[model samples]
Target: MLKFDIFLSALANGLMTGAVYALIALGLTLVYGVLHIINFAHGATLTAAMFAVFVAHSVFKIDPYLAIVMLTPLFFGLGYAVQRFVINPASHGNDSNILLVTLGLSIIIENALLAGFRSDTRSIDVPYGFSVIEIGNLFLSTPKVVAFFASFVVAGLLWLLLARTDTGKAIRAVAREKTGAALSGINVDHIYAVTFGLGAACLAIAACLLMPTFLVNPRIGNAFVLVAFTIVVLGGMGSIAGALVGGLIIGVVESLSGLYFGESLGQIGIFLIFILVLLFRPTGLFGAKA
Candidate 1:
């Protein structure tokens, strides 16, 4: 009975945490999907949003969740500017430039955050942040549950934005074939900016939702990037649905590994799964080879 209880507990916890993981990976997948550019700076974007939300909460007493409304637009603008000035200019050159530039950008952002935030861990305080709910033999962390729900809402809305909007159609067209999209008079470059902006905005949503659940610091990006990258590759680089499912799988496996072995072993388990996936299904769960 105790073993069964532990198993159930691990499963529940995994599902909750996995939801947020999926949200984090979603932005990464989207950017790569549309722009064909693997954004090595994605983790920096996550850290930046977390810091922005923390500052807003600290100075204005605004709810971290509420601050996402403004941060989303602000991030979108920043992303658009980045894509326009940096990524676009590099697009004309060798594809390797995108990789190197984004990698350098990530380092720059991390150091900037270290200077600004002083390497202290910061988090938002909320009334229900540490609360938990009991159902049968399971215990649910309140913040995790809330973050999970928020992730689902954002995911659904993103699906609509991609599937329904005319702008979305253009973005999809560009993703399918950039040259064809330009030939069709869709302004492929502008669509690239929009897609990058949308991806960045997704990070804001994920950061805001996570503010109550996790601590943020200059190294937080470094901490989570590995997991996020694994989830992205597991789900097939740009497939949103794949990200969601892959997150759940990774979460459960991680939880079980920690429960059975140890926390350090859990990290090894993640890589083991990642390696297996790469060997057998490099294209990923929902991704088709381009």
Candidate 2:
């Protein structure tokens, strides 16, 4: 039998890590739902936010958390403008073209970061980086706990915004059916911009929260982006709840695979699981039928 103690510890860590993955997948799903765009640039946007926080800490001596609060709105506006000027137009016709454009955007951002920061892995040195909380035989790192809680709070707020507010309802309407939303007097373009902006804002939030736990580098986003895509595919394309559940599921599976099968095969094992899910439930657990 599997040891209960070890399983509980692994489960805690998996859920905590999964919370971060869920945050990343949330943004991907939001963009896909509203704009029908895969947003290859989402990860790059997140890298940019991480770099922004790093700069604030290194140059201005500001707390990383405080810097995130200050920088989020700026990145949110940047996302809105990018969608309004570039992405929104391409979204209307030939989605492949839009995908290519975003791919180019991702390349541009990554290269720019390489040019500016070099190919070095950097981290924000926060005072709490070494802190942890222990309960019984279980121990939780402060940074991971914070990241997890922040993800939950952000997800909750997003849920409330979508379910309770008029703007949220408008966005939901557009996501469900753009033509019907337009017929009902919702400005489709504005809703699209808002959705993209919100998605990008979530990326910024996730980047900031995760920086203390992981090393920051231009290429780091590439790894997380792949995982995010897997989460989105497994959860059901454009399904928010699926993103949350799928992220946790993947995290636990990976943790267990690493413990039993070894780190090299862990990711491969997850991919195998993903393939099986596709073979059985092509639409994903929560995805709408294509």
Per TM-score, the best of the predicted structures is 1
**True-structure RMSD, every candidate:** 1.4, 1.7
After superposition, the stretches of candidate 1 with alpha carbons farther than 4 Å from their true spots are: 91-93
TM-score of 1: 0.95
Relative to the true structure, candidate 2 reaches a TM of 0.95
Model 2 residue runs over 4 Å out of place are 1-3, 90-92
lDDT of 1: 0.87
Q: What is the Cα-based lDDT of residue 247 in candidate 1? A: 84
What lDDT does the true structure give each of the candidates? 0.87, 0.86
Model 1 pairs whose backbones collide: none
lDDT of 2 by residue, 190-227 (tens): 88888888888888888878877778988888888888
